[model samples]
Target: MIIDLRSDTVTKPTKGMLDAMMQAKVGDDVFSEDPTVIILEERLANMFGKDRALFFPSGTMANQTAIKLHTNPGEQVICDKYAHIYNYESGGASFNSGVSCRLLDGNQGMFTANQVLEAINPDAFYYSQTSLVEIENTTNKGGGACWNFNEILKIKEVCKSNNLGFHLDGARLWNALVAKNESTKQYGDVFDTISVCLSKGLGCPIGSVLIGDEDIMKNAIRVRKIFGGNMRQVGYLAAAGLYALDNHMERLNDDHTKAKQIGEVLSNLSYIKTVEPVETNIVIFELHEGVNEKEFVQKLQENNILIISMGSNILRMVTHLDYTNTMHEKVLEILTSLKF
Candidate 1:
């Protein structure tokens, strides 16, 4: 069997999740009549203690919508240089929102409150006005690093004092919540808008939800429409989200456990250069300066094991709900036996 460790997004719906989807009562979400979708939205909103929640087909849309909702044209956003919005969202912030990003040189994908203060543009006509700040938890590029919640609170204070809108790219937030022992309402109290994904560790086939106050999110639906994110009969997918929320959250720690095991094995190997601390399910490691990443990835593929390269010499493997114990043992055995 092929062991696909590329991302948590790769998993198929579990039998239980699919059963929920098949049984879901669906309606046109564009007309706000999908009962199951409404329930999912309200459940997440109430969990976060927010006034409203809106669903999107993908996390990128939810995040871009938040950016658009918070800023006007020719504005700026502050984020880490390694943030998903800056690095992976394909310039949607600039192309769709007409805003540029002020990338802070941060640790992994996290930056300091002091960095936020420094990155703000002077209120001069020549500079793009800094209006929003976005952060990612369980930082993908940082080998699933969980942000210190205290630092997040400090950043929120900075945003409030500066009158800047704060947004969270919480795609892997369930993993963070489990790993860090943080609460949802605490985050709801801080960020102006928060986007969480259902397709990552939660194991839904598709969807992300953006949560925020009614006043701040009043225009979100309109923005979603303009962005072509409106849906009909989407409760079938929403049902999977609802099911995953109920059944899939606590099991994420198992993924984290297996990832740490992989890191431990990699660290002991003489051929491996360095491995990032495995805080969650992502294992990022680099090769010695001259080792070819493409060759290494090819070797794994040749053995029917799959992962991804995070640029030259750096590679990533993500453990998820579907990465079984048998697969884990096989991967470890293959890794231990590999040679350049």
Candidate 2:
């Protein structure tokens, strides 16, 4: 059987999720009449202890919208060097916001409050006004690393003292919360704005939510429209998000466990130089010299085991709702049998 570990974004909606989507009550959301979308927005807002939430077609749109709301043209956003906003969003941070990023060399995608304080520009006519700070939890490029709550609180304090707007790229936040046993309200209390994805480990087909105060969300809705993200009859997708929120969250621990199991198998491989700490649901490892990434990936492809080779001789595998325990065992067996 094919074992797809490329990313959790590949998960298909389950039968129950599909059923919920089909039964969703839809309306023109732009006109503020979509019952299902309204329920989803309210439910997520309450879960996170935020004043309001706005739905977006994708996490990228949600993040971009938050950035647009938090800063104006010719401003700057400070974040980790490997953050999704800086690395994976196709330079949208600059293209859409007309702003530059001050990237910090954070550990596993987490920068400290002191880092933010130091990155802020002095009040001057020549410098771009540093107005925003962005953070990613369960950092994708950092092998699914998570931030400590106290660390986030420290950063929040710095933002508050400096009057900088704080935004969280919480695309895999559910996974982080599960891994850390943290409550959604705790995150809500710290971030000025948060972007939560429904398409990742949550198993929804599509959608994300941007949570913030009502005033901020009002601006976000307009930004969403400007970005071509406004949706009508989107309750069909929102229904899947609601279903995932109710049923798919606690199960993410299983995915995390599976990732560690894969990490264990990779650690024993002769051709693996090192395996990054398996946190949340991602396992990243570096190949030993002479193991060409392309050829190795091709070999795994031949076996119908899909994965990705990140740069620097690194390979990444993600466990998700669709990946079962049996699949994890089979992957281990396949790795154990491979020869360098």
Question: Given candidate 2, what's the lDDT at residue 54?
Answer: 93
User: What tens digits encode model 1's per-residue C-alpha lDDT throughout 1-340?
Assistant: 9999999999999999999999999999999999999999999999999999999999999999999999999999999888999889999999999999998998878889899998989989998899999999979898899999989999998898889999999999999999989999989999989999999999999999999999999999999999999999999999999999999999999999999999999998877899999999999998887678888899999999999998868999999989999999999999999887
TM-score of each: 0.99, 0.98
Question: In model 1, what is the error at residue 272, expressed in angstroms?
Answer: 1.1
Computed on alpha carbons, the lDDT of every model, listed in order, comes to 0.94, 0.92
Q: Over 4 Å off in model 2, which ranges?
A: none
Question: Per-candidate RMSD vs. true structure?
Answer: 0.8, 0.8
User: How many angstroms is residue 69 displaced in model 1 relative to the true structure, after the best TM-score fit?
Assistant: 0.4
Off by more than 4 A, model 1: none
lDDT of 2 by residue, 45-156 (tens): 9988999999998999999999999999999999999999988899998999999999999887888878888899999999999999999988999999999889889988
